[model samples]
Target: MSGSDRRRGVIALREESCTVCMLCVRECPDWCITIDSHVERVPAEGPGGRPRTAHVLDRFDIDYALCLYCGICVEVCPFDALFWSPETDYAEPALGDLVHGKERLGEWLGSAPGAAQPDGQSASG
Candidate 1:
């Protein structure tokens, strides 16, 4: 896709870089991030099969209406799971429209725009 086809302002997750330390989970102040496990299928090239990987993210919700966008959670994430993106065209007419959960968080993970923080350097993961 071309650059114009992309989103302009938002926040997102970098899953591959996620260390699952749960710092964002704990520091959210909003109970946004929830840890969970799931079955993952490795690539067929390897001795692959469905294996249960601790997703660590049962949910990573953000209540935009209530979100001060303080970037507090972003700053506290040790694995760089929380980040700001230039894709903020979110629209919701009702208050309930602001309760974003796992699916939305995962969507951000799927199409964010940069590299995550390096592993091992600790902030709060």
Candidate 2:
């Protein structure tokens, strides 16, 4: 397998794929990930069916200042929401700006890689 696809500069988030499970935030040893979500009741499928609750992601932020770049969040994420982005130019002018919001993280999707297979091959391949 070719190693040209390696780009571990920064972590990016795929908001759509994320179920707000909080696994990444909880697994981060540096406590750099922060996620907030709200529960919404989904309508029943049919007559006499009961409604179910779904987690709506409200906020998901990652503070690069405290991040260890350990890739733990990407590994622990069961929903395949996080990935390593080749975007290393996201340097902040201020300390507070280092905390990237969900929108900002999603913007890096241009370079974010697809899900990888166990054999070091992209799932799409």
Identify the leading candidate in terms of TM-score. Answer: 2
Q: List candidate 2 segments past 4 Å from native.
A: 1-6, 115-125
lDDT of 2 by residue, 8-69 (tens): 88887777779988888788898998899999999999999999999999999999999999
lDDT of each: 0.60, 0.83
Instruction: Provide TM-scores for the models.
Output: 0.56, 0.83
Q: Against the hidden true structure, what lDDT does model 1 obtain?
A: 0.60
- TM-score for predicted model 1 compared with the true structure: 0.56
- For candidate 1, the 10 contiguous residues with the lowest summed lDDT are 116-125
Q: How do the residues 1-115 of candidate 1 rate in per-residue lDDT, one tens digit apiece?
A: 9986653455676655566676765777766455554545544454654544445444456777766565677788766666666656577889878777656665664445553
List RMSD in Å for every model shown. 9.2, 4.7
**Clash count for each candidate, listed in order shown:** 9, 0
